[model samples]
Target chain A: MWGDKLSEGIMSIKEQLQNRFDELTRAEKQLTQLLLQNYPASGLGSITDLAKRSRVSTPTVARLVQKLGYTGFPQFQSVLRAEVGAELSNPIDKYNKWAEHAPDEHILNRFADSVSKNVRQTFSRLQTEEFDEVCALLANTDHRLTIVGGRISRSLADYMFTHMQVIRPRVTHMTSNSNAWPHYLLDMNKDDILVIFDVRRYENDLRRLAEMAHERGVKIILFTDQWGSPISKIAAHKFSCHIEVPSAWDSSIVPMLILEALIAKCKKRIGIKPGAGLTHWQACLTVRAYSESSLRAFSG
Target chain B: MWGDKLSEGIMSIKEQLQNRFDELTRAEKQLTQLLLQNYPASGLGSITDLAKRSRVSTPTVARLVQKLGYTGFPQFQSVLRAEVGAELSNPIDKYNKWAEHAPDEHILNRFADSVSKNVRQTFSRLQTEEFDEVCALLANTDHRLTIVGGRISRSLADYMFTHMQVIRPRVTHMTSNSNAWPHYLLDMNKDDILVIFDVRRYENDLRRLAEMAHERGVKIILFTDQWGSPISKIAAHKFSCHIEVPSAWDSSIVPMLILEALIAKCKKRIGIKPGAGLTHWQACLTVRAYSESSLRAFSG
Candidate 1:
């Protein structure tokens, strides 16, 4: 495992949990999952608190740490505390202040302006042919699709996976766990599509997966922030979305817009009809809403 | 349980599965969860397809259907098909058409305009005071926080939960399962906050949840689409974000912007310093990237 080499002292608690998962006892495995699901922070504070959160005894926590090769709970926590530095993988430690040059305005207005500008700028650079090409590839069911995103962007990937899975078939949303990627990779065949989302503070594992998938003739569709991800070199199609927001994290809003558009277009191209019940129900709701005179600020 | 009164005929498959989950064998329970996660879509396809997706045997599927009170697979399927009509409680079945007034422009351009306008419009009417109040409440660990979102919006809720859980303690992200909410509600105290995201095709169960949470004196902070959800009637703070987009489903981008902004504000309010390790690592990464001279575009 790639992580094993990094295990000496560099591997994160998350990495250790994933690499050593099979060896853990059932109760300890549950605790490991809890720690992994909310790493660093979940491991910080105290062993008693972590144990209470996972509903395990403090001794179980101690044993798990000892099993992971930590001297004890305190050592495990120090490593966790150390991870605070290397874990700036998403939009974080920013958004503490507004833009330096912005004129005085309500913070809400400033954020709105920033996000609105992001959308406008993103579209200005987007290529219609690329968008159409992505839709075409996705509309074809023959292209077994696998989607992966970074720590923050996985939510977007999951959204795309959910919509794409419903619109057609052969869609897979890879778990955030990198250790499981190779198993999923073995299923990839030529002409299959892999949608990768990695913004700034790019993840190397995803790039490695993209390279391997590329070597296997899998077409890559990448969604990255404007600054671009290192994964672009291997990508067959890339959508460089504007993600910079005034917030602590880069926003997923623009990528989300493109994702929705792609889903809508693919659904249109595939041309599958929804159930009659839904059509009737929707029509009724529409009429009722229109007759009642809408109070909604806006709706899709 | 509310599901019982509706179970005779009117109850949906989701309600039935949740209501009867405890009685199922372990494999059947897994099947039940698979169906619920994907809902009407997961159940609407062929029985074999559904079984293969869940890795359950066809007989298990049949037995599960029988246990759910169906005479046979086709009967259970008919119910699933019927749900297509009533399941429009999300941003589904839209994005099939562009605004009639749109000229000969690329679809991506039109979408960018629409979403950018959405951000602008949402901000123009947003109340900064309410935004601040929501942030203040979230910053306070004394006020336990429970967040929920309907069908599609739950992704956003999960994103918020992930960030908030890392930012502070006393945060709970309720599962999409409505049946499980009461258990979480039992722990709510006065001044606790319940943040909800419900778009068009608003969920009745969510409204009921809000009402119940309101009765418990838990402060309600709602993030609803422009058409507005009925839950607004009970909310202490309401953010009616614009969600319309030219897509098959309502766009989550606008609501995402607001959620990120709120998260940023809360993190700021909490004012926790990162461990020395992360601060040093982030500084190194930032310096390296800056010196390299970015090849990509916009950055946060």
Candidate 2:
């Protein structure tokens, strides 16, 4: 019960940063500002990287983590990682957790709450300026957009490709299996944008592909989870989505939300007619109506 | 401003159903109970179908719709359809709508609110008994599961297929192309479950495939938007997700959430260890350490 109470009382790292804001040394305050601005990503990388980016010494970063009640930077990062993982745990896990504390709440209600929280936390972490920059990259007509995602993330890439292709030309979703990366990258240059969705347990091939694109001077926009992929270092623009869910599988809802938002921005920027794609798709459906009608006849 | 106020005052069909619950006659109340138990779907079917199922006269169904303040059942159904569409609209559309009323709120906050509302609305419409029945059908080892989606919904099928494959054997995601349906359906039978995702502007081929599957006596579970596809008539289990968004494209977040929930239930029923799939996936990532390290090298 004490442990449960302690856990309940414990402040999240973000909360700790906010609470300790006034008490920090000038250097620590600067580091905290950087962390607050970038967040999750700022906390995910190695201490040296954090130190360099925050313009603070490595010891200062260690001291800040200590001041936040974490044993060290690794412990601090682990808390961040755990937070991300907890956000993505399955509904059942969340239900069990809720049951332990509040046994009367319905499981479905708990799930709804968790999902809403995940979506909220995701958007809350997003930087508007960074989002706008990525949208600009995607909206550029001259830029050849090549999108790729790890094995599981491939669905997201496909979803984005399908929607983006409707509003703009030359948008390709690269299949991870095709040994065709070399061919696909052959013509890609500085003007091309390589958007990759690589999260934790990231596919090595995807990383290699990102590196290859980076070497070729292709601008890479990386979308990953809070675990922070190695490709983030080489990325021109990096978006770290919060993927934690109560299930075994990472919640793709946040990533999907980002994809939807980005597509919306691209459509707006490209001046696509409000219903051009839907109208075309509807026409295609009409042409196939004979079979649809027959199916309805049988059902009736 | 009055128009905006009027729009705000418009009660969703669900709200109307609740408000009018106490006023219906016994026959209408039975129909109301049926509608309450199988919402959206209960409201989705033709008037004759609803009348027959609710054990009420056709005119009674008409009276019920009129009592709900609609001109007719068609008008009532259109409101339901619009509500569903509004749930799936893009974040920008939601932001603009919010801006017209709540001018000081942030766009990201508005997007978050809309997404949360969409997920909540989707779950609210889902019947617990129906969800459990679907899980039971999916978890039964005796039944072969075949999934198919319309052209745009193919990624969702793939996503479901991949996750289901990990927890259970013999799960198949049938591709819409390759003219492979004949081969895939050759062995399907009464015991098999054919899960089809066909939303608004439903594909003719997918409907035909469902009809063919129906002819073979295979059980059909259809997932569509609130527009309600014709295939619902043939489906043994029909789930209409809220796809209305602020943008031109339908939002798939609600569907994805359902997929995740279904998979979670199936995993629970099948007794799969929570971390088994994740552990194996982690192993695969470890095997590809060279590329991962190379990526880290670049980052460092």
Candidate 3:
């Protein structure tokens, strides 16, 4: 029970500091600064040495340790060591025991929290002026919106493009017709919006397309991580959001949130509202009714 | 906001009753019982009739309203009306604004709470004796394990079955050879384990397979939302859980938790401890090297 309480204390400290590191006291801030800056060395060092290096008094270090919610210095060090170990793990590795220790609630909370952060970040980064411009571009009759993304990112792009296409009728998704992507890009009017998702540095194809689109005077909205990424450099409008999760796993939260926001924005602007009180099941039935004739014709 | 808060208050009452319904006095219990027995009606009714019908006196009824954390009977009735209206809307509808309302810490807490609840409920429902029986069945040399699902459910099942296949080297997933499913089902031995996931009941294939497997004396393990459903009735072992989601929308917390628990249990029994002295990166690289190659091969 003591150990559990101590762990909770330290965990709470880690959490609070994580959220409010900027608001900590000078000594605590100094220690946190040292921990954040020279995390490797400080994380490895003993309490005395950490105190000496961070330029805080030994008791200050101890107090900072307590403030971080650890019973003393040792527990904090152990947690720091584990975190370093996690960070040093390969990016492609599947997280194993992380979820094992986490209850469903914890995973749900983390997932929800992470998703909320992604959504909030996306929402904040989305300027109202830019959003209006994009909406206006889509609202135009002559130009078509071109979306580019592949793999999991493709799924999101496709979903957004499809939903928008139902209302806009001219949104062209690249992956849906990959062979014609270049043609679609080339044929797009200068006023057309090029919506590209190039999360992580992995998708060079997307980055190249965004560059080409930008060069051709197409307005590009690039959803990529970090400011210095290649895609951000060429795109006319860059929306930064984190998709490379710390746990070395794909997160649906970012894409799902982004798509929902985009849909919300589009629906709000264009007066589209899921066919105006049509039940989801009724919509499905309509889809089936239309598709069934074609399917039967083809089969017959 | 007032309507939302009022309904939230009633929800809190329902939650409290859910926790301690068995301990209420006869009159109080009767009121609680009426509310529970006919939630739809109570959710729609005015305070006077609801109280009178439940056999609780006026003061007692007022106290019940107060106990539920409302301002008064009228406030409580307003909440109940809202709840009933909400229920009438659709039970499975996606909460698009669920994240919008949840800020950073709260989102994390709610997600954590959901995950914890799912895990606890899953664990609670899990029988150690059944687990032993399952282990024995799997450990039996004669039994071939067959698993199947589609779309997102398929992805999760494939994840679990693939891991099990790697360690056990005998289990067959339906996705392995789609053509072979019916043939394999027809040839099912009495010792075979047919694990079926019928989340949302989207597919009839799983139910059909389970029934055929059962008729042939094959051991069945079914994970589904409700008891006495098609898959559940045919299974030797039935695990019940609620997805509580709308049509064709697969985002769920409970199903994934159950999948993880099953894998953890099996992996633990198989004695697949984290290979000794492996750095996190090394373990990741080990898994990645193989998974990436397989992913490439599958894609190709």
Candidate 4:
């Protein structure tokens, strides 16, 4: 890789420093580390000031940039600024690192592994008594079930709410932003069951909804990752699981799978039998599937 | 779990049969199996026909209603129909076998396992030569990059496009479903890279866009789960991974992680320096965070 290295055109300043890291005197080494660790500050620093911090001469600072592969101090600073900007835009690497540590496997196997891990963690950490109690409360509720999730969690909430509504036929998903959810909460009552999926630090809007549900005497079933997450404290019943994937970015799918299991449990509770209702559901699927296929065909 | 006692409440016909399965005489075993396996058909079958199929007496079929905890055949059929409807509405579960399995540690772990498995399978199945060629193409592209994804995959595309844009400032994210994207693509040329994240069965609009990009001689990079999936064949450059999740309900985070890896590679290719053009991104975050906090404080 090094042999076919920078074609002289875009050779970065960092590359130049690597080429001469050991050859440089002690003062140059200090300057290099300082620049690498605090490149942003270097962009705004003058040659004299940067040399003072690195304990190097002003001429040595300029020489460091050239050796680092930059045309000059200004060019080196531009590269530094760009690198800092890229980091600020996306923190995905931290999230993906968790996947890298796991052994290689197929998508199906990976899915199974992820879900099983989530279920185990959730079950072990969970107070089964509380889970069953929440189930009991939900089972007894006469009013509709309402689910709330936002950002990345919204897709799971939408799917769960859609299926639950079909099976139990009274589930509603709240689609509004955090601030707007209170209006929806107004429609909920003591008989209603409110399910909230919030992870990590927890969003203020979801926390507010959890609080309001408590005040309204509505049963709240909380699914979150962080133990100290704000939503956990106020929930009437809670299922906590760790989704500590390496990154600061949240790429965990535990919450979504939890919703899937909840839907399954709900199905079992509601009782899936075989007869006219089942036939009706099949009929509905057929019609829906046909419509979907036809739409795709036409659109194509 | 069943005693000779039956609860004096309405129960689905299938449940009734499960309760009465042991009580049925030897002659009714076949009938019970038939009812459990094909509940809908058994519900509609006449007593004589059901008896003939089960090789039992008509009296035995007649006794099934009371034994199964139903008032009559009609009531039994109603429960059967309800079960059938519920089954049709939720078709993913081919069996109740999952209940037989042990629950694992955490949902995240299960998801990771699933992803790792898929990654291994995908890696083995992937055409290395094609992957390298595509990476080389992407690395060499002179024009801005454009990415598109919808539904759950949108997060992955958004993640990839955001990171890539910082490395190459001309990247565009086509997020909305509006027809606005066609106008944007009209100007794309051979120099520009158009990346599509199409997993599973290819989405409709994405297929059309891929076809359009191909026709225009625009460089196309496709990231997909399955190799034979419709989107795979059309791309000028393709990378396949096992993105299938257990739920078949889109609950896995593997694809998002794959996007992360791809972004990391792209970052390496373009040389993600520490201080590069980062103030703009940080400034945006700072502004948004400050404004949001200020707004909250003001309201309080």
Best lDDT among the predictions, by candidate number: 1
What is the C-alpha local distance difference test score of candidate 4?
0.57
lDDT of 1 by residue, A109-175 (tens): 5676677667667766777777888888988877888999877788898888867766666789998
Local lDDT at A156 for model 1: 90
lDDT of 1 by residue, B100-125 (tens): 33343666656766775566545544
Top candidate when judged by DockQ against the true structure: 1
Model 1: lDDT equals 0.73
Give the TM-scores of the predictions, in the order they appear. 0.57, 0.60, 0.42, 0.50
Instruction: Give the best candidate by TM-score.
Output: 2
Q: Write the per-residue lDDT of candidate 2 for residues A172-263, one digit (tens) a residue.
A: 98886646666787788888999999988777778787888888899999988755688978999887676766666677878887788778
Q: What lDDT score is found at residue A147 in candidate 2? A: 93
Error of 1 at A257 (Å): 1.3
DockQ of prediction 2: 0.08
Instruction: Judge the docking of candidate 2 as incorrect, acceptable, medium or high.
Output: incorrect
Model 2 C-alpha lDDT per residue in residues B1-300, reported as the tens digit of each score:
366335534866655654455455668866875665434445554679789998999999999888877899878766654554453232243222321223324344455556666765666677767877898899886788899888678888888987777666677888766266777877889989999999877877787788788999999998898778999999999888888766666878888878887887777667654544554435545655534333443344
